[model samples]
Target: MRVALCQIEVGDDPKENLQRMIDALRGAPEADLAVFPEASMVRFGNRLADVAEPLDGPFVTALRKAAREHHTAVIAGVFEPAGDRVHNTVVGIEATGEISGSYRKIHLFDAFSDRESEDVAPGAEPVVLDLAGTHIGVITCYDVRFPELARALVDRGAEILAVPAAWAQGVFKEEHWTTLVRARAIENTTWVIAVDKAPDRSRPPRGAPGGVGRSQLIDPMGTVVADLGPFPAVRVAELDLGVTERVRSILPSLTHRRPELF
Candidate 1:
């Protein structure tokens, strides 16, 4: 399967952000799937509820059209209204312009002195979407820190994991991002397509919370297939699915799980 890691910078304007997404898809190379960063709808530090929309709203509607036009399935983040707070959602759209699945982030980012729950509500379940016969699991930014979530998705027959993150820059944050992404793929024995927002150049270097790009794809054996550096760019690479089976045949870690003991 060919996948595109769209490491584009996210802005506060939903309309502009949507246009940026469309532009990225329009320029991306031929691929089966394209993944965007968390909060692709609008960047953080702004009032979320004011711009939050439903799954069938204009943002997703436009995405459906773009996905159909580009002939590539897309997994991008958006904010959905959930009463008082918004749900940080990742929507999956197929190449046929159908809504494949949606995953709300269960683990909100409440660490590092920032409280995400203050504005965002938590999700209850994990979501897996099928694209060209491959089952891909969806996970948000902070959720990457939790291995249990990845395990649950893998248990549900997910062969690939999609992580869309707007990981903030801080002390050792980049290390954490790279390590966690590789760890999830290595342990789950599944391919991981981890995409993060390119750093917003408008903001002063140490001014506010923002993304540190470093978007990458890791194979089941934890090999880095493609890594897009900290810049606004899109890169596509063909993923050999057979590698998963080959790695599993040697490791067999998933089958060796002693679930009853845990």
Candidate 2:
């Protein structure tokens, strides 16, 4: 299936960010699915309360509308408000304008001294949903650093893993981003599609040290089919699901593993 990754530079204004995503979607070619990066609809530096919105709020509604208009499935990230706290969540909208499913970021970005944990609650579950004929898993930002989470999704029949990350600009970030993403795909033996953000000069950049733009698509064999550089752009790539079975058949690592001893 053909997937489109929309790599956008988010500004301080939520409305402008949302509009830019919509425009990006319009420019993209017809694909079975489209993915956006973490907080693509809003800047990440704003106060948690100010940016938080319900799962069915305007941002998600607009995304659903866009999906229906384009007749394609969409997976985008948003700050989901629940009761007194908020969570970094990814909402999926089907081409039929139906809310498919949502995945909250289990691994919170706590390495930053700013205390992301103090503002957003972490999710406990991994979500896998149907996209066309494939079962896809959803994860966000720091979650990519956790291999166990990706393995769990693969165990649950995920053929492709989607990551929406706001990787900061810092020393060796490009290498880390590429390395870790390929590692996840190679280990899980599934397709990996990571949609990362571009540096937004309008907003104070992420305090953490790391470069922003490094969106990539990796095949089951850990081959990078496309690399969308650190800039505002869109990348489209075709992922063959058949290759997944072929790779696993040749490797046969999943069934050959001896899990009891570690």
Candidate 3:
């Protein structure tokens, strides 16, 4: 199936951010699945509480409408309310505009002196959504650091890994993002679709690091099938599910794992 990665500029306004997301999805090229980066619903700017909303609220409702219009399954991030804090969530909406499932970010961003857990609650479960005939998994930014999460999704019959991220820009950050994305695809023998914010190449945010775009699609053999440079854009690529099976047939790493020892 084909996928569209929407790399948008997530500024500080919740209203503008939501409208941008809608516009991107509506104008997306023909693809079976459309994915957006984390915090695409609204810019948290480190203050998630101020912009968090319910799953069935305006943000998702608008997304569902766009998905129905484009006739493509949509996967994007949203800040779902979780008690006093919020959950960094990536939800799946079918082409029919039905809610498929949601994956709350298990690995919150707690590195680089930023305390994500202080404002966002951690998720307890991993989720997989079936798009068309392909079994796809979902995870947010930091969760991509943990191989176990990807393994669990593959174990749950996921053939593709969808990562919606707002990867922060910093020293060695770009390298880390590319390396980790490719590693996940190689090891799990799954298609990896990672969408992140477009970095301001000329300037950083408030003299602080901002999101690094570099949205990419990796084949099961770890091939960089498509890469959207650090800019606001929409990238579409077709991923064949058979490639995952073919790679697994040669490597068989998933079945060869000694889970009991590790």
Candidate 4:
């Protein structure tokens, strides 16, 4: 399967962000899957409640239309209304423009002096979407730090992990992001499609840049297939599904785990 990683700079306006996403999809190379960064509907450091909408809202509805028009499956982040707070969500749309599934971030961003749980509700389940005969696991932003979630998704037959992040810029933050993403791919022996937001000057957090873009696709053996630097860009690469089986045959780490002891 071919995948397109779209690194875009998000803004505070939902309509503008939606249009930007559509434009990116329109201009991107034709692929089976296209991914965008977290909070693609609106950037962070702003009131999420102001632009939070349901799955059936205009933001996602427009994305569905764009996905159908482009004939590419999409997995992008958006905020969803959840009671008084909002859910940090990643919605999966099939190439046929149908809703595949949604993953509300199970692990909220509570570290680094940022309190995501204050305004965002935590999710209780891991979601995997079946698109074009491949099972893709959905994880958003901070959830990439947790290995247990990725393991659980692999256990549920996930061949590829779709990671959409709005990673903050700080000292050693870029290294942490890259290391964690590669670790997940190597440990789980699953393909990782990590797409991060581009540097945004309009919406910086704590007087620093919001996203340090190094969006990449990693193979099961932790080999980076492609990396889009720290800027707004889009790149498409072919994903050979058979590589997972070949790597597993050599390493076979997942099969050696002793679950009873842990």
Instruction: State which candidate has the highest lDDT.
Output: 1
Candidate 3, 1-262: lDDT as tens digits: 8888889888767778778877777776488888888888765554677678888888789888878887888888889888889999888899999988888889988899767788889999999997756778987888999999998998998988999898878899999999999999999888999999777444422334467888999999999999998889987788888887788889888788887996
Per-residue alpha-carbon lDDT of candidate 1 for residues 1-262, written as tens digits (9 for 90 to 100):
8898999888878899999999999888488899999999999888889999999999999999999999989999999999989999999999988998899999998889878899999999988888656899998999999999999999998989999999988899999999999999999999999999998777632236689899999999999999998889899988888999999999999999998998
- Model 2's lDDT to the true fold? 0.82
lDDT of 2 by residue, 1-262 (tens): 9898888887767888888888877877577788888877666666656777886788888888888898888888888885666888888888776888889888887774546787789898999987656788987888888899999999898889999887876666677788999999998888999988876555454444333777889998999998888678887789898988999999877888788989
In candidate 4, what are the lDDT values of residues 52-147, reduced to their tens digit? Answer: 999998899999999999999999999999888899999999878899889899998887787889889999999988875699988888899889
Clashing pairs in 4: none
Which pairs of residues collide in candidate 1? none
Model 3 lDDT on a 0 to 1 scale: 0.84
Query: What local lDDT score does residue 144 receive in model 2, on the 0 to 100 scale?
Result: 87
Candidate 3 — which residues are off by over 4 angstroms?
200-207
Reference-based lDDT, each prediction: 0.91, 0.82, 0.84, 0.90
Instruction: Provide backbone clash counts, one per model.
Output: 0, 6, 0, 0
Give me the runs in candidate 4 sitting further than 4 Å from their true place.
204-208
Candidate 3: Cα lDDT at 235? 76
